[model samples]
Target chain A: MKQFLNNLALSLVGLFIVGGLWALLSATVSPDLPSPWRTWQESKVYILSPWEKRGEMDQGIGLMTAYSLFRVAKGFFLAILIGTPLGFMLGSSNTFFKMFDPTIQLLRPISPLAWLPLGLVLFRQSEPAALFTIALCSMWPTVINTMTGVRAIPQDYLNVARVLRLSKWRQFTKVWLPATLPYMFTGYRLSLGIAWLVIVAAEMLTGTPGVGGFLWQEYNSLIYSHILLSILTIGIVGFALDRMMGFAETKLRAI
Target chain B: MSFIELKDVSKSYGPRNVLSGVNLTLDEGEFVSIVGASASGKTTLLKAAAGLIPYDKGSITMAGEAVTDFSTKASYIFQNYSLLPWLSAFENVNLAVEAAFPDWPKPMQKEQSEKYLQMVGLGAALLKKPSQLSGGMRQRVSIARAFATEPRVMFLDEPFGALDALTRATLQQELTTLCRSVGRPVTALMITNNVDEAILLSDRILALSRGPGATLSPAVSVNLPRPRGADLLMHDDQAIRVRNHLAEFLLAGSDRERPAQRPEAPAASKDVPVEASI
Candidate 1:
């Protein structure tokens, strides 16, 4: 409890320092930059009534965040479903690794922007295209991490599997899966972070109704304060998502 | 009857040979230990006999069946405990029990696991994971896992080598008791650097020569009576003789100049009767 309070106090102090600096900048050197007070006042409607909808592009901050979260969830789960088995195969089979590793390495660093047009051509719909971009961009982490996890299973544990004469199926389920879980989770966490990041860019390009969409829409409208609000919401949500994954990873390691 | 036999076993890693012309046999219900210095190919020999790794030459057989791979009839206790960190004590043991007796009812498997953990004095720690347990306790869980399978032949590769002297002695005693009390006789093959542990546990002790290519010395019979303890080892003359033979073989093979002093026995053991060991 004391540690938590200490962290909270420190966080508040940090926020205060950054806020004061921003206020000072707006009042002096950058007069066109919105001050903290002005931003808060202008953005209060979104904060106070986060689920409200004024128009097609004017939904409250909560609704926008929820939409972005939904798309990320869909894409992240899709990445997991495909990437996990791919990783398992790559990790366990030398032939599979030799065959696919080069291709995966070649494709891994391609930007979501580069993939978006391809997604659009294949899916022919903005939503699927956005999801395709999000999944493809985020999947590399899960695939790589899972493979590394499988590779990293302690030799003693594998020896135990062999000594017990555990059937291949039992070895996969009991030894391989459990041993790989913590690593797989690390992959999932990274993948989710990537998915969240890709959703913003995907939504920006696709004009979807989400946090990224709201940021783009407000920027086009010259609503500078709302753009700040969207950015803050994205930062806070991404932090929360990461913390949730970290908590899960801790639990897995304890197991 | 010979329960498990390995004749002229040899193994190599790349260009370096680990074991060469290693011949060993364990009679039914016998407990045999191979004592050697570190890196003397003890683990390689144990793994070869258990069929965990393929030997370059020679045949291993259990009950007249040629051993080409790890036999389901055997169980292994590794030096490092090797308990799954994700599993509780009961679960670790239960996993082996389930594999060894797959057709048995789940409740029966659970019962068997609980019984073995309790036998190892881990009834209170049944729910504890390996990380939550101390080194001694984790090894107890590994021992429980090994015995729970009711393996026909047990291979122990320096099972207590990682433990402190006190914990190692305590576990050696517990293992001795467990071996004697189990319902059916189990043929055990163990490897260790500890001469006293071999004296305390085995019916016979063999020495593995220093490696590039290690070979087993002829067996030295550990004819000390059963129900042995660390105290008995000091009190008995035969124990001293066996310890010296094994220790000398080890010291002779190693490059080290001086032997480390053995830990002092408890003062209370001074009053123990010599006849008690006989």
Candidate 2:
């Protein structure tokens, strides 16, 4: 309890320092900049009654956050569904690895934004273009990590499996899956973080009904306070999602 | 018929031969130990006998049946005590029990796992993971796993090689007790570098020349009485004599290249003079 209070006090001091700088800058250097007080007041309008919706482009902060979250979830889920099996095949079979590894290596380093135009052209829709960009960007970490995990399984463990003559299904479930799990979770966490980052950028580009699009729209009208509010929302949500994945990883490790 | 037989067995990796013309035979209910210097292909020979690896040129049979791959009737205990890191001690043993007796009920499996673990003095460590246990304790779990399967043949590759001296002695005595107490006959083929360990545990000891083209020496039968403990071996003049002879043989063979043709069998225990040294 004492440590917690000390930390809280330290956090408050840090916040005050930042607030003081922002207030001074806004007052003296640039009156156009959103003051800390203005940002707080503007953020309250959304935080107090966050579910209200006016129209397609004028939805509440809550609705926009939900939309962005749904897109991230869909893209991340698809990446796992596709990437995990490909990773297993690549890790297990030398022939499969030989065929696919070069292609994966060539493509992995390309930016998600580089795929955005192609996704937009192919899908011919804002939502799907965003999803495609999110999925493509998020999948590489999972594939690479899962492959490494599978390859790292101890030879002794496999020898044990062979000696026991375990059925193929049992071998997969009992040995391969558990052995590969910690690595897979590492991939999952990285993929989720990348997915969240991509979703925001993709949303902005697609001009869809999400937090990124809302921030872009607010910027167009020069509502710096609303833009600041959206930035805070995005950062807090991203941090929460990452923390949730960390919690899940810890739980699985304990098991 | 011999319970386990390896006839003219040879294995090579690329151009280098690890073992060559290694013929061995063991009777039912016999405990045999193969002692060799490091990298002398003792492990390779053990793996071939267990059918874990294919021999380049040879045949291995158990109970008149040609063996290929790993046989379900035989269990192997690795030198490193390869317990899965994620599993508890009980879970590791339970997995083997499940594989060896698929049709047995869960309660029976649990009982058998508990029984063997208790015999190896790991009953208190059932819930501990491999990382939590000491090296000696981990080996005890592996030993329990090997025995719980009740295999007709057990291939142990330096199962006690990693333990400290005190732990090794205690486990060796426990293993002898367990072997004696089992209801059915079991033939154990173990590889070790320790001459005293071989003398204490084996009914007969087979020495190997150093590789890359290793061949077995003629078998030296241990005439020591059963229920033999370290104390008995310490006090017995015959046991000390046997240990010295085996050590001398290993030391003398260290520098010479193994002969291309198989050497003639060395004289058995009866031929060696009681007063002979080195």
C-alpha positional error of residue A251 in candidate 2 after TM-score superposition, expressed in Å: 3.0
Q: Put down candidate 2 lDDT per residue, B23-125, tens digits, no spaces.
A: 9999998999998876778888999899888899989999999888788888898999988888899999999899889999999999999999999888899
Angstrom error of the Cα, residue A195, model 1: value is 1.5
TM-score of each prediction: 0.90, 0.90
Per-residue lDDT of model 1, residues A1-255, tens digit only = 999999999999999999899899989999867887888999998889989999877888888888999999999999999999999999999999999999999999999999998999999999999989989989999999999999999998898888777789989988999999989999999999999999999999999999999999989988888887888899999999999999999987875
| Alpha-carbon runs more than 4 Å astray in model 1 | A1-7, A27-32, B251-278
- State the local distance difference test value for candidate 2: 0.87
Q: A136, model 2: CA deviation in Å? A: 1.7
Q: What is the DockQ of candidate 2?
A: 0.58
